[model samples]
Target: MSPVFAHGQLRLYLLSLLNEGPRHGYEIMRDLEQRFNGLYTPSAGTVYPRLAKLEEEGLVSRGDDGRKVTYTITDAGRAEVARRQADLGDLEDDLDRSASQLADEVRSRVKGEAADLRAELKAAAQEARRVAQPATGEPMSGRARGEFEQAINELRQSARSILRSRKTAESVRAEALRIVHEAKRQLDQLK
Candidate 1:
């Protein structure tokens, strides 16, 4: 949860969003996630209750359209939005700040995780090379070393590409961790 949506601000913001157009609950949740850059995704539990509350307060009205219920801002909702124009502006500013901060935090965490993964991979490669050495204590053959290095480089590049892709940071992080873990597992098998 974000402080931007604290203290009944989410209700007001939801009203602001409905002011733009009518939407179902899922669309409202998706819109909020997009607006926050995927940093905050409100579950149905969080959103539906607030919507129900707003409906109870006569700030919004819902129309059943078969399987979906579309919510629209009532005249009272528009009035509330009009009355709290300044607060809405402040909330927007807070949202921008919070999104930026969350993005930075996610980047920092991913960077740290990537660094740790690199260190572990490097150590595992060195250990594998050591363990696979001949009785003469000779290093791995040049061809074998080249192939190993290339594989490691490719893995690193794949992780970097995932991080830089258009996917959300959370998804990127998960994919990167998956790659790292799989690589580690494969490396451990060589032991």
Candidate 2:
């Protein structure tokens, strides 16, 4: 659970989601994950209990669609959503801040790891040079260049593998476009 949502914020947000359409527990979780750009996903333990509470409170009704149970917001839930529309806005702002913070943290961590890797490679290169020096005191340019090339190739392969495993290039481009559109919207709001 992210602290981004205050005490009862998740409950209200769930109602808002149901207000849009009826969804099972898993669908709601997936919706939240997608909304946050895969940054936050609530587990069944978290969502199911909350749904049960909402049903108990008469704010939402549950219907069994085959074996899956779907939740629909009742009139009471819609009234609550209407009453706290401003709070929903605040929830959106909180999610934006949380996503930005998480992105910053990931960026800084990757930068630090890359810097450390560079330092280690430099030290290893120096040690290799000391060990490979001939008695004639000649520079081992050929060997050093080969080793550097191999290291670069290995790094390239690792990067390519990661990119291939994580997502398709098209999906990455789509996500970038989504972010750009969101930024444009925020800028337009300012004007």
Candidate 3:
């Protein structure tokens, strides 16, 4: 299945995470972090709401043993988890063939790519922090702050493309790639 990374997706993740056994929210996050190799350790805000949603859907039932709210997958949730597991297997096999090797090939590719991404994000955050300093640019006044918020909103909108289905994701990826290419061209022009 196309694993959604949104807050709503936490239902699927929580169900899937608890397929082996019951777990609380933090336990679910820890399991996901382990499974995803620390690429995503979902925050409480993302996890809890999704768990609540799952409960409402009857996919995840909560049992307060004593302290923490323990969640176990229902029969419907188990079937959903089974379907998703098969989907995940298909996705994995496709990824394996796409890279023309085992999953390790992709993992090997990530080392450099992740490092570069970390550095770039770090630089961007540093730049943003520097630019947002109270001493500079009048602290982003009314219209400017609105514009910044608008930009952020658009980014979140685009990021939501990942939540789309496989067919839709293909189209979204094309658009995203086009945008990335344009950004690269602009950066080259700046250089």
Candidate 4:
């Protein structure tokens, strides 16, 4: 459910959208998705049914554009749009607020998660160096240094792969935590 369309707002907004010009179902869906900054996308199941209902209500007329159905607002629909001018304004404001809030939340979470991952990686690198260095103050053997570097490189590549994938902030955070815990467990077992 979209925070932008809480009640019958979607219906009115759809009518308003048609008032602008005749649009195909996909166009309407794309416009809505763009309006919400890609945060909310209405599926075909959600959009087509509402368009069918609007046609049934005589508020909109449907025409065939090649194989596609395009919706155009009727006089009644225009009247409805004019009648609910204030509602349209309110809906626009709500959309603006919702999009801004979602963007801010994503930005904040990404920053925090990146910082946490950086700290964990730094700590792990420091620990690896400490372990590689012997207590006798002797320099680390070539084999020990190579192993440590390989492990750190693998960890860095894994983190990069995870971050590059598309996922919600919560899921990314959870996965990062799990990876960190698993790394710690493996390091402990090596003791």
Candidate 5:
């Protein structure tokens, strides 16, 4: 699961790294691991394909340096990097929130309550957290049911909060419904 996120992060990091100057693929990978505190290291199999995609998208241009692929970001690539920079938080926030969410759920569920409820909730939460987080420091990504549910829950809570603040019941319902529609769009992206 984390491979997908790593792939995306690697592409962005390469773009950012090459902004300093054109660099070979190995240099970009080394720079990414350094920046991430050795948290992520992409295999050649992963990095090359994404580089190919970037080249295909015209975000990257390659210079011949013997057998090495030296990549320079094009004007279009620069624009995409900028656009992604703007939407970057939306992508990043999911991983960020997922981490804190596990701790928060653990804290809440472990608090005083009925024994069965505590035990059951704790076990379920633990399993979910384990599934969400990778053994390595890299985060889990890819289209999966867990992420879809989390996104839906986020939208549902957003809607409920919006609904709560409204003065009229009709407005509240309308706003919540709008949020639900937005949630569906988010889910569709996973597919």
Candidate 6:
């Protein structure tokens, strides 16, 4: 997952959130998720530990009601927030950019998958046509059928390898090799 905050930025952001008003831990988490446009949601393990640390540092105080513990910024926490106002602004900008980038990546991936589906549909249509009307009105010879199945198997293997590598340079190289091999096979078939 993309990081929503830099190393020390979450602590500062939490302080700023509390500076706005007292909030329960779940409220803080939901507020953060909203702020990031649902791109990020902090787990309880992540937020509660940091809150505990802030309490230890005397920057925040927690009040336990029967069911929920609400946290409020201490005077020191407000002062810290005020002092780092500029830093907080920068953090907000970074978070906005990160969310936009993540959204863009998701969109691009969906487009790619759609394109792949279209190509597969086209290939299946072509294969159906070939099967329905053979060149000599006869089924493919055993050797020709074997070659066709081998080619399909190779294509599946290449696709699996590429997906496993996730578009890395090594996967790109493997794709190139697969293309070269297929080209050579086609040339041999022509002869």
| Order of candidate numbers by TM-score, starting with the best | 1, 4, 2, 6, 3, 5
For all candidates in order, the CA lDDT equals 0.79, 0.71, 0.59, 0.80, 0.59, 0.74
Q: Give the per-residue lDDT digits (tens) of candidate 4, residues 40-151.
A: 7789998898899999999999999689989999999999999999989998888788788877777777777767675666566566756566557888888888878876
- RMSD of each candidate relative to the true structure: 7.6, 12.0, 14.1, 7.5, 21.7, 9.3
The C-alpha stretches of model 5 lying farther than 4 A from their native spots are 1-10, 90-191
Model 2 misplacement above 4 A = 120-191
Please provide the root mean square deviation of candidate 2 (C-alpha atoms, Å). Answer: 12.0
Compared with the true structure, the alpha-carbon lDDT of candidate 6 equals: 0.74
lDDT of 2: 0.71
TM-score quality measure for candidate 4: 0.65
Separate clash counts for every candidate = 0, 0, 1, 0, 0, 0
Q: List the residue pairs that clash in candidate 5.
A: none
Candidate 5, residues 90-124, lDDT tens digits: the string is: 55564455445544543443342223333433343
lDDT-superior candidate, 2 or 3 = 2
The residue-by-residue lDDT of candidate 1 on 122-160, one tens digit each, is: 655564555454667677888777766775676677667
Q: Give the top-scoring candidate (TM-score).
A: 1
All candidates' TM-scores?
0.71, 0.62, 0.43, 0.65, 0.43, 0.60
Residue lDDT tens for model 6, 1-191:
56767899889989999999999999999998898676567899999999999999999999999999999999999999989999999998988888887667656754565455345434533443344325466777777676667655665664565456543334344444555455455444543
79-156: candidate 3 lDDT, tens digit per residue: 888888766565545533433442344455444443443344344334434334264435667765665465445544
TM-score of candidate 1 to 2 decimals:
0.71
Flag the better candidate by TM-score, 3 or 4: 4
